[model samples]
Target: MEWLAPLAETGVARALIAAPTLYLLVNAAHIMGIGVLYGSILALDLRILGLNRSVPLHVIAGFLSRMAAAGAGLAILTGLCLFSVRPVEYAGNAAFLAKLALVAVGLAHALVLHRGIGWRRATTDGHASAALRLSALASIIIWTSAIVAGRWIGFL
Candidate 1:
């Protein structure tokens, strides 16, 4: 923390601390990105939970996955930018650390599902197994937890 603080304290940190309003604006942008990202992820996960059981799984996957990919991309880009502005503080933030871990898990799940046999079979059958359903439930839980953790980073 000491190492990083000094580096930032000399560079962009000065500009950032000087313009406190930028902090609020960037936070707002970060939130909007997260909302879009999580909203799309939840939509896809809920669809897999049979919320729209009648729709072909691949069609739903194909459509919503694209939405999620775009939103997730934006979220990640913004998140990285935000992190750069406060790396030292974030490194010491337990909630931020937890949020980062949750995001890693979520990304791994998305990648695995996108590439693996289960999702492929489920898509072809238009029916996912109970395990897949459980995974969808887990996604919702992890994502919700991540959002709460991210918000709590400021407080704790």
Candidate 2:
């Protein structure tokens, strides 16, 4: 926690604090990133869970997955910049901690599922196994929880 103090003193943090509009822009960017991430993941997960049977899973999966990844990358980048503004406070905030943990778990779960044979098979043949469906369900839950926790941070 002591080491995090320097983050608040960094140039980025100073700039954010000095420029109100810059902070607003960064915050807006972060929101966009989150929107993209959640929207893409929701669509992909719903598809895997048997929504819109007319569409091929593999086709949408690739595009949505890539979109999700891009969103996540943008979110992470902007989030770090935002976090730098008050690193120590955020580090101590329970809701922030929970959000971070949930995000980590979600990412880990996605990685494991993507690396497994089930993901490969599903993406290859457009058929989701029971395990894949279950994973998709879990993903929905995890990501939703993470977003909730993120919102809770300000209240806490």
Candidate 3:
């Protein structure tokens, strides 16, 4: 609580609070980042789940993964800026906590999947094994849940 007040009083937070236009733009950027992240991940997960088999998995996977990474980076960076504006309030929000947990799990899942041999095999062979497909399905669910929780934050 003590630290959160300081965070909300930081230069970035003070500037955003003073400039409504800047805050709005930052919010828009955050939304766009989430859209890109979810969209690319959805496409890649679907491809792994037997959709768009006509396209090569290696190519699609590589491109979509990069796009997802970029989007995640942008989303995270902007998300922190937004959070800094009302750190104490947001910290107490259940929806915000849920969203954070979901995102953490999603990132952990991605790291494990990407670092494991299955990802390499699927990318090289252009074929996703049953386990990989299951992981893809899990990825879809986890990311969707995270997005939903994020939306829920506004209502709460």
Candidate 4:
């Protein structure tokens, strides 16, 4: 906090403080993006876990993947702008650092491992695979952790 306070007194934070509404808008966009992404990811996970077997995993995964991808793109774009608001504050914050780490791991899982291995394995027979189940479990942990860390940033 001491270090962050000084960092926020710098040029970038000064600018953000001067234009608070801009920061708020950027944060709003980021939140919206995360909401959509989470919605899709959670739905797919729930389906994979057989929470809704009637929906057909393939269709649910397809739809959710599309929505998640779109939301992920929006999140990345908005996150950049939000970071500009107080780069030093974020860089110095423990909760922020944890959030970034979780996001990095989660995005990596989604883009590479999940898409290449987990998803393909699951969708090959138009049915869910064990990999999909494992992935869903991991995804939930990662996203939930990210959310908790992000929330802690405000309190801290």
Candidate of highest lDDT: 2
Q: lDDT by residue for model 3 over 58-102, one digit each (tens)?
A: 888888999999999999999999999999999989999999999
Location of the lowest summed lDDT over 10 successive residues in candidate 2: 113-122
The best-first sequence of candidates by lDDT reads 2, 3, 1, 4
Model 3 lDDT on a 0 to 1 scale: 0.94
What is residue 99's positional error in candidate 3, in angstroms?
Answer: 0.3
Q: What TM-score, over all chains together, does every model reach?
A: 0.84, 0.98, 0.98, 0.82
Q: Backbone clashes in each candidate structure, one number apiece?
A: 0, 0, 0, 0
Ranking by TM-score: 2, 3, 1, 4
Off by over 4 Å in 2: none
Give the higher-lDDT candidate: 1 or 2: 2
Better model by TM-score: candidate 2 vs candidate 3: 2
Point out the worst 10-residue segment of candidate 1 by lDDT.
7-16
Cα lDDT tens digits, model 1, 7-119, are: 46554556656777876676677778788778887887888888977777777777777777787777787676567677898989999999999989888988887787778
Model 3: lDDT of residue 112: 95
Over 37-76, each residue of candidate 4 has an lDDT whose tens digit, in order, gives: 8888888888888896777676666778889988888988
RMSD of 3: 0.8
